[model samples]
Target: MAIAQSLTTTASLHYTPFIRELFDTLLTDSWCEVSSNRAIEFVEGEADVAVEKLVPYETRSEQGIFFTADDITMKIVNSLAAEVAVEKSFFDPSCGAGNLLLGIAKSYPIKKNLNRTIEYWSKKFGGCDLHDNFVIAAKLRLIALAAIRHGLPSISEGQLASFVRKFDKFYTGDYLEADVGGDFDCVVANPPFGHVVASRSNEWSSGRTQLAAIFVDKIISSGKKGQKLVAVLPDVLRSGSRYERWREKLAKETSCGAVELHGRFSKSVDVDVFILNLNNKPSVVGQIIEWVPPVTDTEGSVRLGDLFLVRVGPVVPHRLEEGDEDFPFLCAKNAPAFGVTFPEERIKFGGTKFLPPFVVVRRTSNPCDKNRLITTLVKGIEPVAVENHLVVMKPFKGGVNSCLKLIKALKDPKVTSRLNNVIRCRHLTTKSISSMVLQGV
Candidate 1:
């Protein structure tokens, strides 16, 4: 609510009366001239009163509602719009306040004639959301948009007011429970991401189901034949073990592609996310992903891939690998500076004696903290394996003699800082970690 009010206050100072009147008209159907001359003191006081009326919800629900910035929504819609013609109809089953719909509505050329713009806005989009308030908000925004299409400069109070209660742009109901009819050419959204809660208020709230999964299921099963869809979802959906079935379903069922987004929407959201485009007619043969490598230059740094016999953790239960035996399992927490910290709680999973000497580096760290290039030297006893979260760096067939000096070189502050600066997103990957430069360590 404070966010909404802050924006209003800014508009009051910089905007003309006509524009503020238009916005004030949206929030409270009262049409009046906006006054900026009432002094900053008056504006601040009024903004506080307006904020008090808002019914705010905590943003921490497992099923999140991180609204996408308008620019972000425009990009996703434009990407899908590029695939299919924009003149055709589109839908957002989870459209909240109609941002995506409004985004699409505004995508067409700004109208020199309000009638033409209204025609395009009316025909260019349609949507369905679960809440009445969102449906109403979506309509109000479109009306304001209709006023803009008429050219914001020429809008009269009566002319814009006439647009009110006129749009059948969206419906209010659970999108997953029913098909809110429309053979839309495309469906785009930033769907909810996370495990369901137990309020019995939402369909999957009581189960372990992820709401995002349910949204996808609905889009695929209910969409018209050949309908294309673009959505923003938690990155885990692209590769989590539990979601393997979901991937197989797509491989055998629809033509789908996913692109991971780089920087986060805001600092409050830490989870990495990806955009997915799916179609019934096999728009894509298989999955296509874009993974940008993290790279940097340091005085004495070298690519881990160049010297290490990199292997991911064996795909077996670490606990099940426990054969009532003590095996030196290299977990990330066990790395202690230049030496290895073999705590009593080590995972017991020594598969064979053929394992060779190797050094393990922590895979990820807090982005704000030191680029934790914490390396552990494993050489005194038989070589052990590491958890998947750790990158195993071993000598290439005949490249380097020992990982001892390599570990020491990696600990250099400049080396670690350079390596950290190369992060594509917020963490280090074995692929990225292995590609750093190194002095002849």
Candidate 2:
């Protein structure tokens, strides 16, 4: 508690002595069940601390507890609340400081016409976290939000107690360890990402499991029939060798859709993220949605179906040596940048044959970046077999030119600027090549 108090105090620069003293009192209090009067006192004290510390920081700065970009959160909230008929009860399993929840709540329409809907939805919204500090922060955020919506900073003792009781919605246990009791109408979470090591008796070790894959599985398992979920997943889940079976299992178990976001949310780890949406209803075979930059004034967003092919890189056994000419490979380590360039010495001396002309995208990496696409327009090659750690995509038969167009189009400053460290490639498809040739005409 001293550590918490010190951190909070240092983080808050504009607290009055009264507010500071109140916080110091609450920080030392060990009551598991705080009285309503104490809760109100605590909230008022914390609000002063938060207000001082809540000054906006640059989008890329790490000052905020939530790492995701604000724009990303806005887009997510907009998408989730787009349809009014959908029972929109928001739930975040890893509700860190309630940022996502707060963002959603703040975005809800406050006008008289929409007040009823907002109130109805707020009552149904729920969230939970494994950290006690986060629960406290989330409750403070809710109190602050209530103050903003209404004109008072004070809640009655009973109301304050009720708020703390609901704040119990935020738990203090491992998400995977708990039963999660009832399924949510909609679940949104950003679970931890990385490799998951499970013993023989653990559920995820039937084969290799990416942390994101396991978390995705957990989200789906936590949902009841008709429940939908949106969770942030590492790019590795989309393109990792360890996720092949997991992907198949997920696809088979539920209908899934995703939106890919480049760059790390907050941490230095440059992981690619996707907003995955799943439901227990019959599979809806969702079309891939790519967020291309705006086009002409009249045409802003474009949604093309089946325009790109997605395939995984070849998997060579670990026992195989590098000199194998029969199956030349491209491991994650060898993935090239935007332009198809690799160390020639490694190519020649490493004894790996050059893959044929095809676009090779890295399947997995420690820090997922945007330049995952690799274009190989080096002429006179046909479908090349990609090695483990890379996924190759070629445009359909007539897409050679389109593929080329995509390559060139991707070279635009706008596209390339975003592509840095996120995408890479070494091959091209006939359709891609064809597309490149006919782009502006």
Candidate 3:
């Protein structure tokens, strides 16, 4: 008997009336593990319904629907397959419960018309997840889905285990350290969100780095010539900050395209996601495409690049003290302090020294709406010294004209709201200070 069948059969004998009812309710509906305090009450009601009906508990304990939002899954699969030819093999580095894998499998044939043969399509699909439970659950889900379509019983556990072993695939391990060897035709994944602090105790410590950025680096390193990749990333990278240098290098090393996804996909984690495609060829300069679903906006369309300018903030060396009048400074501490006064002291400008303008944006806010970029419209005014935590960006070409435009654009309620969640301020530079500025222009 199959493992699922055996587990179900054994469950029938041991399950109580209430437990049996709960099992039946789960089997019939979209229920997964309910841990929320409020959700627990609903589970109890469903359990009562099962008990009143005296239903036998025949559902398999391990079998439950992996909850990946269907809409996001569909978009990701469609977008990826649309970008690349179907004949190319696809891999998901962190394929959570194989939702993306299954979506790709379904869409590949219809979109590309390359998977007419069952064996051919199966060979093209590959995925890996660190969670053993998720891996097993995904294997079962895939086998079940395949069985329904192909008219066969679910694959036996032993057979499934063998399949994983034969491919040298599906071993449980951290994706960061996993050796995914060589380049794949296409790579897709929604890696874990948030920063992973590097400490002496951690095995994967490589200084302090955000987990999301590291995933991008890993994908680039794992990719081979002509390999294509799609990943969901936070909007933090768009700012031309120090992080941009890494992204710029990645872009140069592997030509890449980005598409941003707005709104919340997971109720548990609130983050804006962007889908990035990386290929071995040189990227077309100035090519940026932003896709925000119709639900996110009634305005019809929005481009990710148009909404904001992403750049690194100013960096103040330790030599500059807080009260020193030598330079104007905006440090992280000044943010939210209330009644903090700007120090007004001027120092002599020497060779290669220039005062750059900047705005202090608070880093923590929902949708990043609290952050504002400050630029002075007055010409020939040098920016005060910026302390750490304040980003300084001046017009690259247009002087006061550009600064005015940025300030006007950010003043919008919608844009300001988003800025507040991520940035404390955006600092603008004067025409005289920018590297690109011609002496008298």
Best by TM-score: 1
What local lDDT score does residue 68 receive in model 2, on the 0 to 100 scale? 38
- TM-score attained by model 3: 0.54
* Model 2 ranges with Cα > 4 A deviation: 1-66, 82-87, 107-123, 156-159, 198-208, 256-269, 281-441
Order the candidate numbers by TM-score, best to worst. Answer: 1, 2, 3
Model 1: per-residue lDDT, tens digit, 265-339?
545567656667667646445653322234545676556577666655551453545545565555666667567
CA lDDT of 157 in candidate 2? 40
C-alpha RMSD of candidate 1: 8.6
Instruction: Give each model a TM-score.
Output: 0.63, 0.55, 0.54
Q: Which candidate, 2 or 3, has the higher lDDT?
A: 2
Q: Go through the candidates in order and give each one's C-alpha lDDT.
A: 0.57, 0.49, 0.46
lDDT minimum window of 10 residues, candidate 1: 35-44
Model 2 C-alpha lDDT per residue in residues 252-311, reported as the tens digit of each score: 666645455544553443455656666644446433333222233223322211454545
Better candidate number, 2 or 3, judged by TM-score: 2
Best by lDDT: 1
Q: Residue 176 in candidate 3 has what lDDT? A: 78
Compared with the true structure, what per-residue lDDT tens digits does model 3 show for residues 319-361? 4333423443344554333222343544432212223322233
